[model samples]
Target chain A: MPEMTYAQAIDHALGQAMAEDPRIVVFGEDVVMLRRELYVRFGPRRVRQTPISEAAFLAMGVGAAMAGLRPVVEIMMVDFIAVAFDALLNQATKIRAFSGGKWNVPLVVRTSCGGGYGDGGQHEQCLWGLISSMPGVSVAVPSNPQDAASLMISCLQSEDPVVFMEHKLLSDYWRDYLGGGSRKTVAFDVPENGRIGKVEIPVKPFPPGKGKVVRKGEDLTMFSLGVGVHRCLEAAERLEEKGIQAEVVDLRWASPLDRELITSSAERTGRVLVVDEDYSAYGLSGEIAAVLAENGLRPAFGRLGTEGVIPYDVRREAKVLPNAARIEQAALTLASV
Target chain B: MRMSAETVPVEELYRQMCRAREFEMALARLWEKGLISGEMHLGIGEEAVAAGVVAHLREGDAICLDHRSTPPLVARGVDLEALVLEMLGDPEGLCCGWGGHMHLFSREHLACSSGIVGSSAPLGLGFALASQYLETGGVAVAFFGEGAMNQGMLLESLNLAAAWRLPLVLVCKDNRWAITTRSRTVTAGNLARRARSLGVPARRVDGTRVDRVWRAARWAVERARRGRGPSFLLAHCPRREGHFLGDPMLRVYRDPLGQVLEIAPPLLRSLLARPLSRLASRVRCLGQIGATLGALGLELLLEADPLERSGRLLEPSMRARVEEEARREVEEKVMRAMERRVSRA
Candidate 1:
């Protein structure tokens, strides 16, 4: 067992995968901060730098993947993915199906996302929902370091295109970078857990299409992903103080959602609360609600999420985003209902 | 591979161009018959450029094409029947009927085309980037219109290719019109200068002439194969069918007098509004109509079809035979494509 930050884990997994496979090549703007060690180690050919052209670079990743090269392309920010959306949605995702399975884009688009950092509306979006909604491609959103590394490895090894979303709050370096007005310090598996603070890498993969119930409970089921997983745990702790017995489940992947786990969990509790860091409308929250409805579970449902915008002011952002307090309050309402 | 470029077989290149032209002609017939859905874009006049450059391609070479992709795809030896079936929205077609003419792709040939105007550059650069890593010693060539050069991705691709020294040949078929708008008016600065600024060697050639396009493409592809980075080729050609099938402008090309009569009433109505006071304005308005006709005249003046132009390079008897063979081949493809099938594309 080893301890590493979420970003460090991404680096470790990508490095390991690249070491195992020479076909893998990394490219992005300045090779992305999360993959600095990769640039130093893999050098120019493997870990390449690019001009700030999201469309070209992203499509290049698609082309490379088609030509038998595993390319991990960093689009810099999840918001920046809009610039590369055409490449991702039209080219990367549809290449395999369009070419009659003759061409598969084994690409990993690593983009940093999520809000509560006060970077304003443009930069602070967690729009994995838009990507996940697309027919082809898999989206992996890791909640902790171990999952980040494990999922990163899986994304690299996938025979198809995958988008690896790195939440800003989950990254250790990003936390230090945006430390100015960040009120809530989210420490998910840190100094408190002696095992998590170790230098060795943990490659224990929970695997894709599986959700992990971090804190098991019986009263109510709380669904979350990315930074919201930590928020859900915090809310669960407070819910426990009031004897609510809220279960916290970390949904690591956005697309190809763990419907089996989600439906089973909802079936057990018969009540669900979806707390998401992204906007609730057509988001992961709505998706979970739809999944539940499709599976014939119409329990006491409640969802807490951003109102489609991440404000520039830190206080306003924290207030807008799904925090532990909001999650707890939402849970209380759902429990009462 | 270089020998393919050096010899410049006139009859062989002519046959390729003829095959592309006849294929598009058959596609046009299908479109006219209301078989193909959506906007039909034919690379009717760009046969020489496609045949010229595609002639130099080896087994490992890749191609990325723009909306009017039939020329390159035909030159690349993609199944003509499959192409026709794909256009007809048949399951046993290229791309399994998922992609139309513009978005056609073939993994076997390492060829792809997109309806997105400027996407060819990025997609082609991706192939070039892979070839660099694969060490296949193969070069990638992208065929796009001059209009696509304005797109951010194409510009970025040029910079990336030049900076990384990826084996890429950016072939810009400068039809001089971006859809309906004259390219020179909207297109800022010189195109060759734009490529030169990006550290790429650029050359402009007569796109109607296969010999010229062949030489230019051969030189550029060789430069890329040598690991010297990307090269830009501006092949100035004509779009025989303007922009797309069923373009309103096509009506203007056919029965110009009727079109003028259909069009002149609006201008004539303005003249009748104020007979004397708005005289100067009326003259200026007439000048506008005259300019449109002048543009049409300009289009007619450059009416040298690439297939016909290249065919003349061969002996008259041999050229006639080649043209007949190409026509028969395309006819057989159209017949096969029309027959129902439940097999893979």
Candidate 2:
């Protein structure tokens, strides 16, 4: 085990995967230099650089995938994918279905997502929702370094196309694992069916279909994902001393919603609050609310999310995202009611 | 193959144009009958370029065609029935009914065609890059119209291909019309000159003559395969029909036939007199069709009844089975194609 930043973990996984399989090639704009310097001390053959043509480079990745290569191609920013959409949506997505499951495109397109860089609209966007909606593509947005490593490795092993969504915000966040005596890194074997490791944090047994309760509570169930999970936990701790217990659930994976945990928690408290950074309409929280309603479970409190697109203003974005104070307030109001 | 060669018979070239013309007419009828769903962008007058360029390609060489490259695609060995099936949204189509006629690719034929303009050039470079990076001795040809010359992405591809010295042949069929816009109106100067400025040797040829295009394509493809770099072949031709099947283009551009009649009356008169020699023309057309079918080692659908149940070669049950079974078949074909490509390494 080793202490690794979120960005370092990504480098470890890419380095490990490429070493394990020669067929695996990594390429993107400045990825070769950045990954090599920041994370892995590897050669150019494994981590290749590409020209600024996103469409061409992406299609090259697609061609490489079709040619039996496990390619982890990076799109420097999530927004840039719109330029290479023809290759992504038209070519890579449909290769398997169009070929009737005959071809397996083991392609992992890694890119930095989310806001926090103050890079404006062009550089910051959580396109995970849009990408997850596309068929024949598996979207994974890891909240921390451990999940990033786990997901990147899993993406390389999967037969289908995977969008390994690495957020720019959590890149420098620190975490630890015991070092494997590996100052001089060597290739490690990968499991046939990729591995996904969960971090316990202040919670436990973080599994799909089951959300961990960060703080045991009976007042309200605070459901959130990614960075929102951390905020909800902070809010829950603050509300605990005020005699309002808010159970916090961190949804590690978004697509395969943890309905059982959500419904049971809603049933226990009779009140639920869903918080997300994206806009309220057509957001993940709306879908979760719809699911609970469909399952005959309604909470006293509803979704807390931005009404529209996140404004470029840093202050506005922070206000739009449900914070610890907002979550605590929402939970206490539901408890009193 | 010479830098200039007149290998195709002018009469045969005219017949190929007529085939494209008649095929488009059939497509129009099919659309009206509600058999075809999507907008059909036909390649009526661009028969010579397709015939010439495709005639130069070997079995393993690949081509990336644009929306209006139907004539070239057909010339490259895609079945008319399959193409029509695609237009009809049948499962037996090229993309298993997933991508109507607009997005068509056949691994067996080693060609990929798409509907998006300016995008195919980059994809073509990808195939060429794949060949070079993987060390496959194959050339990738991008068949684009003059209209695509102004596209930024295509220009980017030109720069990339030039920089990397990739094995790519960028064929620009200058028919002078992109949808409704004239090439002269959009392009700054000669398209060949544009390619030449990119530091690659380019030539302009008479696209009406299949042989000239073939000769030029041969030289370009050879240079690319040898890793000398990319070259552009600008085939100068004329539009003989509307931009697409439904486009009433006569309302826009002045009909060239009227102008040709005024300037080159004897040449126009000779072309007009061609139909009067009907019996000889019919025999020659039949012979050519026979030769083409023979070359492909396939029997003419007209010659033998390949089925016992009906006038069609395929029985209704079999056709239904083909439609039902096509999804799996396409998948298997793509997988096999991928595997075969991998084995080549």
- Best candidate (score: TM-score): 1
Q: B61-94 in candidate 1: lDDT tens per residue?
A: 9999988999899989999988887776666678
TM-score of each: 0.52, 0.46
lDDT of 2 by residue, A9-63 (tens): 6766665565457788888754522453311233445566554457777888888
lDDT string, candidate 1, A243-280, tens digits: 99989888889978999999999999989999877788
The residue-by-residue lDDT of candidate 2 on B42-61, one tens digit each, is 66556667766776677767
**i-RMSD per candidate, Å:** 24.9, 28.8
Global lDDT of each candidate: 0.77, 0.62
Each prediction's Cα RMSD?
21.6, 25.3
User: Which residues of candidate 1, in runs, are more than 4 Å off?
Assistant: A1-337, B1-6, B255-286, B341-345
Q: Which regions of candidate 2 deviate over 4 angstroms?
A: A37-42, A173-215, B1-345
Residue B290, candidate 2: C-alpha displacement in angstroms: 66
